[model samples]
Target chain A: MSNEVQERKARIKDMVVSALEVEPEEVTETAMFVDDLGMDSLGAIDLLAALETGFGVEIDQAELPRLVNIDAVYEVVAEVAGWPLTASA
Target chain B: MNTTTLVRNPVITAWSAVSPFGIGRDAFADGLHAGRATKLALDKELWTGPDAEACLVPGFTAAGVLGKKGTRSMDRATGLAVATVGKMLDDQPRGREIATGDHAALVLGTTTGSAQSMMDFTRDSLTGEKPFFVDPSRFPNTVMNCAAGQCAIWHQLRGPNATVAGGRVAGLHALNYARRLLTSGRADTALCGAVEEYSAARSWLDRVGSGDDARVLGEGCAMVQLECGAEDPGRRALAEVRAVEFGVFTDDCGPALTACVRRALDRAGASAADVWAVSPSGTAGPGEEAALREVLGDLDAYRSPDLSLIGDTAGAASAMQITAVLAMAERDRGAAGRVALITAVDEGVVGCAVLGLA
Candidate 1:
């Protein structure tokens, strides 16, 4: 993976760890937020706000529920922030 | 049949305070004993408004004391209440043991949940690209009952959750509510208290609302565990809540308070001379002080209100007043089994509580 991919993942991980109150190691690419990270409805809202704040992007309200894990969040943030989605993946 | 005489007053089996001096009961006790001021220069980053100082819980942050988990959306008032409940439970094994069951209840008092949270949420909605683009997570904090609900949620208090908002008398309202809950058999163990948060919004409101009388806005939480049924001889307690009486002052606060204090003393089966300590709400005018002196005049009791030590704690003021008396009781062996009084007069309301020290 390119440095861009690593950086985006790292930044997204930081947001997840802070917003969801999960450990960095716990926010693995496939780890589900509600199932694995102990996040509930409020946590989901907080994470969505954090994404909008951290990336300086606007995410569709519908996209909040789809942000199920680190990989999902990385994709959504990259897309909303206008990063090259294909290269990020 | 006089119900007041037959009613079993719940003993405060355990109590805790997260005060301007610091967190926990011991810190508050030390500060109260010292009777020193707790006002500090406001953090410039946090506030650069008209007020330059406040009595804030030293080095307090929602995430700092409660950890990062579930704190991102927790406002200061809720955070303080949660922390105080945690400390109260941790202070006594009985509180933890009794309050963990389905019988536990919570009653929290606040001026308003957190003025800052409400203002911030409103600002977000008004400034967002779309009116609905605001963070929904903050909506909970905007409500006056949020801190009480959060305390119940955090502490697993499953019974009779309540929140009372009556300005400085909010704490008294909460204590009375808890007593009723226990008397009504709605809860076995009721954790009750009040909290206030120092913020730019609250400070601004305090200044405008209180005008000349507003002292340095102070913030903290103080909680007491009220248990029903028989008192356990093995456990230590701050006081047995003898009586809590509240009345409205249509015109004269002094006369209203004097009557309320007399009623409370009568119900508690105690006289004015029996009161070993008195913690008056510092926000009220000279009327409150004069009434207190008239009732417990020339007594050798500890008569100082806790305002100088903790500043105007707002909703937490009454609780802190009770805490001042309790803190002194903890140090003096002679204070055990003595009666202590706490009184508050806010706007149209005058209230008092008599505690039989344990």
Candidate 2:
């Protein structure tokens, strides 16, 4: 994996933990929001907003279905922001 | 009377309404008597001129109605639900579950459920860095059933409780459900009504229409206590639920609404002549107005005079119209001898309720 992807992943992890008030360990790349963190509808909304502003991407209501996990969210943000993943940032 | 007959005639023992006018029965009574319109002139500063005017409940604070602990976990919908229930329960001595032992279910109706919270979430998600920063306590309050759930929890009601949304017909639908519960002996007394919380999104939709959104933006909560049989003691037993009919009509509002009303009356074992008055779904939509004029205009007994004053209250509109019908019944006991038809339609969905004087 590229360093840019790794860095963005770390930042996303931190944002999720801080916004949801969950432990850092609770927010792994594979951790599902509803199943792993018990994030309800409000939590989902908050997390989406945080990701949008932090990564400078727009997540419309139609795109909600695609944003189920950390990787999916990161990919969308990175792709939209034109942040190509590299071995080093 | 047999259980079938008794259950068929459920009575409203107590009721309460909180609206733009103010709190309690007297305020509404005064407002109605003086024909005071609670609608506020649209605030140009807050919103554009077209969307400015709305009937908003003034001086409403969740803190005042639902104490600190209660308000902390509640959304605006639940807050209004609990407030209206509190007022209704206060009027009756048997509301105490400890005293009654039996459970009291609450059935609340609304067209736009948690839409306000959703709008807030949209704004925050679109602007904020981390969406998860949203308050944890506000999570449960975002559901459509939040208001009903909170009311059940506060009142300690363990029986069936639900929140229904069907545009203008929601209030009557809630009462209809309450009636079924009472008749089936599922609950002895049910707190039933409808509430609508106007939000920015709703306002925008109102403007998007051909500038004639019949459905007005109204924020308020109103509840009526339903009990089985005439033995119940309240003087304002605002008519009994005889029959409730729900349907959807794409076009031709005339035949559709008339058929629904006819079905309700047929189920109630009443006729047009038996109906003293008609509380048509007064959304003030051009389509509905024309349809109602055609339907009720032919009937000399079916008259409506409240929609002009109350405006359209959405989910709470049916209850508001029902309240007006009940008030009429209180004044003219003879009207009670006849059935009153309360009908509401929105977005092509039509709901009709037949209320006979209890």
Candidate 2 local Cα displacement, residue A15, angstroms = 20
Q: Each prediction's interface RMSD? A: 2.9, 7.0
Worst 10 residues of 2 chain B by lDDT: B94-103
**Model 1 clash pairs?**
none
Return the TM-scores of chain A for each candidate in numbered order.
0.87, 0.81
Any idea what lDDT model 2 has? 0.71
Q: What is the lDDT of residue B263 in candidate 1?
A: 96
Roughly what TM-score does model 1 have, to 2 decimal places?
0.90
In order, the B-chain TM-scores come to: 0.95, 0.87
Best by TM-score: 1
Cα lDDT tens digits, model 1, B1-358, are: 8875676778787788999989999988888878778888887887855687788899899899999878878999999999999998887766677785688989888887899999999998788765666667778999999998888888888888999998888888999999999998899889888899888888778778767544777889988888765557677656888899999987779999999999999989999767778888866777887888788885345655456666778888888877777788888898777798898888899889999987
Clashes of each: 0, 13
